[model samples]
Target: MNITLKPTPEIILTGDRATGPLHLGHYVGSLKQRVFLQSQHEQTILVADMQGLTDNAHNPAKVSSNILNVVADYLAVGINTEQTTICLQSQLPALAELTMYYSNLVSIARLERNPTVKAEIQSKGFERAIPAGFLTYPISQAADITAFNATLIPVGDDQLPMLEQTNEIVRKINHLANKKVLNECRPLLSNAPRLPSTDGKNKMSKTMGNTINLGASEKEISAAVKAMYTDPNHLRVQDPGQVEGNIVFTYLDAFHSDKDYVEQLKSQYRRGGLGDGTTKKILEECLQSLLGPIRNKRAEYLNDKAQLMAILKQGSQAAKEKTEKTLFDVKAVFGLNIL
Candidate 1:
């Protein structure tokens, strides 16, 4: 009997959709993990232009415009370019081919059943006109993961269903070929998964217009704070404020480092003394303290557009080489390659 050795698990694949500038929600949810994981793992950050276009097909220019913004966000948030390979998703032909191959292993019914897809379609109000590409993205995501043989995928808990779908496809291909050509990926959920929108939406998203941009100016931050939803019942400053649905306290809970102060404010608000203005003021300060440096770093990266694109192209080339080998092995298994 021959003993087979397993490669040490290190390859990590994680990224952002190139639709807009990353916001405070993204920074807290996923960006923080990318920063930490890059140091320990062979990480590849793909600015997912193809994924972005799945929904924004009509506005292709939005994806292109935001690619550099995503790059700047990644670099500014401390995803070291030297350590973490940053690339554009469209540059890799192998990923597209792999997606096609993997798509054959899945069914239309199963794709329709994906909870994440269903929830997203409902959220976007795309029930009547849902795009086929948008519905089948799990197959493409599986391609991205298996093509890189990614063992670690940093994501939120809500994305667990997508990983399950990916592993199912991997198992199907491996079982049919009688060989382990693909690896199943595991999700590393962020400690702070999301920051609720100041505008009282369940999630903070660009579409919701409820986000505080990572690179937002002082005026923008102040404006967002002013617009933050507070206690509707607390009409007067002296009236008791409920913290449960109040977006101001929600943000304060997440951003304000001073827990003792936050708890004190909570007590005052509950007892009917603290005003929304005071809470907003504190939240703005906390955000300014946190986001000020990130804006500066983003500006530095944005100022040198040529260098940013060059770095991304280099990473794309490296990614292309890796995915090529994986695709070659997969094609060979299926007798699709003449070799």
Candidate 2:
């Protein structure tokens, strides 16, 4: 996979909601890429607690408690706190100020038209009583990127529309404010953004009970991998199976060390003699090899919770200092500075 080279180190904005422990789907889909990008770009990973609260507003404790869990996930996955700034979104006041300004730039109808938000609303069954905060989160995300003056946003394909909306706000704000304060952001769309659940559902979600947490115990991971859904039609060990839709093969494609082995397995399965047990065992071994280090790192953080919190606090402070400067400039542009 070729990473596009920027003329200078481009600023990047990427993050996850702190609703639960980061899962395998999260690692393969985005975090793994993020770990690599930190060395090449100016990256900031936001623990999006503020956004998580949009839907879970009634559960403040859930959002607060998981902030560190999400940070731990970041650290365990090799997102170096020294190289990448990881911050809590709610701690940055500039984001709210920028979100407010961007809100005015975007119409309510435009927010309604965002495909990502629309799909989420329908999936969550919040059709009629959509929370206002939830409805405007794309704007908040716009605030997130522009506050950092980020030039690239790593997001899933489903979030392409949200990036479009953010760019629209950037363009509008730049024109209206009569300054090119906000940079137009390009979407770094992941090749496999939406990893399906082991059950072969369209998405792997914590709420859907289809996720393998990054911090899951060896036993837990073994159980989950054992029960993973494979090609249902391949009922017998001798029956020829289709590897195209097999979730186990998908995991292999995403995480395996030897592509040759995966290809051999696929060919054998397609040719009619590969047992599902054999294929699954291969996948389990490949995945365990990949996740073992991450699990160990997570355990270390879990054992030393105080040190983890200190890292988060340090990162959050650094992030706020940068964001505060941007907010001051934005306020000056709008003539809203009171002091």
Candidate 3:
């Protein structure tokens, strides 16, 4: 009989843009998964300042300011600092070097066809008038993933193309060098990956002024709840309501833990007796309960800026060492290590 040993756990790389404070959309989308991933794998969270600046170059200060906020949000959401390393993308020189090399392997046409990049360009109204960096960010993202040799990346449906792009680079590079230096990453898609805007217009974010932040105040939560979009046709309590397109109910479905209670509410609303006011009230309460502890934890992290900065610095150093090893291996394979 042959003896078998368990393979090492895979590395997980996931993070957020420091464009603004994270909101519930991020929580439902990736943060919660990251919190769980910490213990299960070699998880490293990147505060993607460089990535965030691909579009925010005009206002670099905004990108700089939100770095700590994103870190605080991560810690607040239960991302264990001990198990998961949190690093700043800008501090990782190896990642930038990797991006430059990876760019050579990819054609301009391939970059343009990236669905996530294309959608982002359209959403930002850039069309063809986009920055080169914005267009080549998929390569940057690939560098971010490969530097850590990450095998599992938590992403939404839109980011699947980016992951595909990363693995494309991995295959090309490894095949060319005949060495598996870069690891291919796959997406961990959440069942409910995106939360629509509070008013159901589109994304929930700072630009839209529609998101409820993880550290939102009670008053702010109240405001978001009141502003939440419900089926316009369901004005009267006795009117038959629609649950399919209601953003308030959508939020409840994501945040509320009690399945039976939520089903009861949905039944009442669909059966023509539940008022929008009542449902909104329930959602507000659910959000408040969910966000309250996160608010406290975020506050604790923010209050001690020195400690937060220290944690990030330590993690950044660890990340630098890992990326350095990868860069050294990659350079040796290609005879690019002239230094």
If ranked by TM-score, best first, what sequence of candidates would result?
3, 2, 1
Give per-residue CA lDDT, model 1, range 148-242, as digits (tens): 99998888888988999999988998898898988888887778836788788657677777889999999999999999999889988899889
TM-score of 1: 0.93
Off by over 4 Å in 1: 1-9
Q: Which ten residues in a row have the lowest lDDT in candidate 2?
A: 201-210
What's model 2's TM-score?
Answer: 0.95
Give each model's whole-structure lDDT.
Answer: 0.89, 0.86, 0.90
| Residue 220, candidate 2: C-alpha displacement in angstroms | 1.3
Better of 1 and 2 by lDDT: 1
Score every model by TM-score.
0.93, 0.95, 0.96
Across 197-216, the per-residue lDDT of candidate 2 in tens digits comes to 88886477667778888988
Best by lDDT: 3
After best superposition, candidate 3 residue 116: deviation in angstroms?
1.8
Instruction: Indicate which candidate wins on TM-score.
Output: 3
